[model samples]
Target: MTKRSAGTTASPRPGRRRLVIGAAVLAAVLLLFWQRDRLSPRRAPSEDDLLAASPAQSAGSAPGRDQAGPKPRWVGSKNAGTGEDAEASARQIAEKRLERARHTLEGYVQATRYPPGARPLSEKPDLQKPHSVAKNTLPLARPDHKLTDARVTLEQDRLYLVGDEAARLVASCTTSDGPARCEVLRAEARVPETMPQASTMPPARVAFADEGAGGSTIAALFAPAKEGFGGYHGPIAINLDLRIEGEEGAAQFNVVYTPAPPARLTGDVREVIENGSLCLYLRLAVDKPGRYVVVGRVDDAEGDGFAYLEHNDPLGAGAQEAKMCIFGKLVLDERAKSPFVLRDVEAYLLKEDTYPDRELVPGRDGPFHTTKAYPESVFSDAEWQSEERDRHIKEFTKDVKEAEGELEALP
Candidate 1:
C-alpha cells in the first residue's frame, strides 16, 4: 500500500462519500413534496367545520405551542347533493309560473267595450230563470215494468194575454220505455202566493191523440179567474196529477204561470236594413208605460243561430215601437243568407226604479219576423273596434313577453 507507481492516483474514501450523497438525496425529495403542496389549491373548511371550531381552537392552544386544528368534514355543500335540495329548487320555479298567469287574466276581465248589438243573446241563466223552483219533477214508474221511468211536463207561455179565449196549457207526457200512452187523471190551479181568492179551480179536459212513440198530449187547462182573483193576473201554480196508461203511481206535475202583463205585442212587425244592420221595429200595445227591454233571436236562412238582438228604451201608453238591431259584422261572420228568420221574441217592462226591476211578457211561439233575401255584399267583414279594446289587447301582449324572459333564467 505504501509503494506508489508513478502514473497511479490515490484511492477515494468510499464510506464517507456514500454517506454524504445519501443525505443530499433525502433533502431533494422533501423539497419536491413541499413545492407540490404549495402549488396545488388548498380547500376551505365546510359549514360543519366552522361551527365545530373557534372555542376548540382557543381551548387547545397554549403558549409557544400550536394544537391540531379541525380537519374539513367535507369540501363544500355546493357539490354535496340531496333529494330535499332538488325539491326546493323545483318548487321555486313552479310558484313563479302561477303568479304570472293571474296577472294576465286580470287585464282581460277589465275590458268591456264592444260593438253595437255586440252583447251575446241567449236564454236567461238558471239563477235568473223566473220561478225555477216550481219546475215539477215527480216519481212514477210504469205499471208493466220495474225501471220504466215516466216524465210529464206542463208547458205554458211566458204569459197569456188576458182576453176572452182561455189560456192554453199543454201537457207533454213521456215514458222511458218504448211506446207508452199517458193521460191526465186530475188537474187544478192554486196561486203560488197570497191572493184575494185562494180556492182551487177545476181543469176542463181536452181531447187529443197521442203524438210520438214516447209522447202523449193533454191540452188546454184554463187560467182561473173569479171575484178578487182576476184570471188576468196570476203567478199561478198549475198542479197536474197524471197517469201514464201503463204506469202505476200518479205523477204530480206543476208549472208557474203568468197570465197577464202590462203590455202585449201587436199584429205588426216591420224590418229594414238601417245603418248596415237589420232592424226590426216591433209594434206594441203598451197599456202601461215605462222602460221596455225587447229581446229577440235572429237565425240564418239555414236555421243556424246567428245573433241576439236587444232594444232598451222608455215608452208611453198606446201604440209605440222598439227596434232590435243585428250588428253588421255578426251577419258577415255568419256569412248568413237572406230571408233570415226572427225565431223568438220576448219583452219586459221595467218597474220605475224598483227592486223587482222588470215584469214578464208573452214569449213568441215560433219564428216572429222574416226578411227578404238580401245579397251578402251588403255587410262588412271587418272586426269591430274601439279605443278601449285596442289598448287592452296590446298591454296583455307585453305581459306575456316579460314572463318568458324570467323563465329562461330558472333551471
Candidate 2:
C-alpha cells in the first residue's frame, strides 16, 4: 500500500514474506562468519541425529520437520495453559524451540550446494553470510499499508539494460473488498531530473479479470522499446498512473532502475557434471565485464520444478563463460527428470553494493530456453561433498549438541 515518493524506487520494503523458517530460533547461536567456530563441550551429533536431520526435498517444508519430532508450540496461543500446566507448557515450548534451533542449524549445514539464485526458501536461514549472492528483484508480495480497498505490487527485476530491446514491468493489483476493478491510465519512460520523455506507448485500457469471490486482479505489462530509454545508461525513472475502483483520480507512482551496459548471451551452451554438480556453461559476448551474476530455473521433462541455477563470477572482457551449477544430491534427492528445460534465464552486471545494484544484460528475457532435454541418466546421483560442507558440519554439530544438552538439563 506504500506509494512511490519522488526520486525513490517504487518497490516493496524488505522482509515481505516470513523470514527463513526457524531463522529466529537459530539466529542467536548460528555463526555469521566462516572464521568463527563455536565449539561446545557437549560433543557432536550421533549418526542417528544426522539421519534424522536429513535434507528435505520440498523447499517449502519447515527445517526440522524432515524427521518426526515434537511440533513446536508457537508463542502466543490463546489460553496456552493454566497455572501448573502453564509452567509445563512453557518448558515444553522452550524445549521445542531448542529442537528447532538444532534442526535449523543442521538444515543449513546439510543443504546441497546451490547457486544463490537457486536458493530454496529456507536456504541462508541465518541471513548473515557476507559471501552470499543476493538477487536484485522487486518484492514478491505486497507491502502492508493503510490502503484498505485496493493494493498494488510490482513483479520485475530491479534493473534493465538499455539494449534489452524493451524493459517490461508487470503490475499486479488486488482489492480487499468484493469484485475490484483496476486500470492503467498512463505509463511513460524517461531519464530522470528533466522533462518526461515522450510516452513510449499510448495509454491503454487494463482489464482486471474478476475471479469470482477470490478477488479481481490485473497485470499491466509495460514493455517499452530501446528508444524509450533515451540513450541513457544511468537511472531510468518511470511515471505510472493507474485507476483503481474506489480510488480518486490517478494514483501516481514513480520507479527507478539502472540501465545496464550492454552484453549478449551468444546462444552457445554446454552441460557437464563437475565435482558432483551439474553445470551449464553459457557463452557471452561482452565489451565490458566486471562482476556478473546469471540466474535461471530448470524444470524436468514433466515440467516439474527441478533446480535453480546461478553463476556469480568476475569475467574478463570478450568471449567469456558463465558456469551455473546444481548440486548432484539435489537432483537425485528430488528424483528430477532428464531433459531439463531451462527458463527464466537472466544475467546482470553486479555493480556497487547499494540500491539498484545491477544492470541487466540485453536480449535475455522471457521464457528463455537454455538447452534441450538430455538423458537424465547422465547426471550423478551422489550428494555433493566439499571441505566447506565438512567444516559446516563440524561447527553446526556443536550447535545441535548444545541445544540437546539444554533440553536434557531442563525438568
Q: What are the Cα lDDT values of the candidates? A: 0.57, 0.54
TM-score of 1: 0.53
Error of 2 at 187 (Å): 5.9
Model 1 pairs in collision = 143-247
Candidate 1 lDDT for residue 61: 17
Alpha carbon deviation, residue 198, candidate 1 (Å): 3.8
lDDT of 1 by residue, 1-411 (tens): 589889999776999889899999999999998897666433344433433433211211111211323322323234334756654544444344434434443434332322544443333243122222334444454444466477666555333333332455565665665334666565555555464434553343333445555557656646444212354344555555556755655443333333467788884788778667767789998978988988777777898666767788898999998877666767876667878887667677776664345666665656888887877776665555666555654654454554565555446
- Which RMSD does model 2 reach against the true structure? 21.7
Worst 10 residues of 2 by lDDT: 128-137
Q: Which residues of candidate 2, in runs, are more than 4 Å off? A: 1-101, 110-161, 167-228, 240-248, 253-260, 363-378, 402-411
- Give a tens-digit lDDT track for model 2, residues 1-411: 867788986544457424553576467556543224333212223323533553333432223332554533324333334556655755564565566667656566455444344554234343222112333322112233333455555444433444444334445555555344545555555555543433433333333233333333443343333335434445554554555564523332233433445467987887786766667788998767799987776766687656766788898899999988766666766777666766667777887876457666754434455455445565666644556655655655765676677667656
Using TM-score as the measure, which candidate wins? Answer: 2
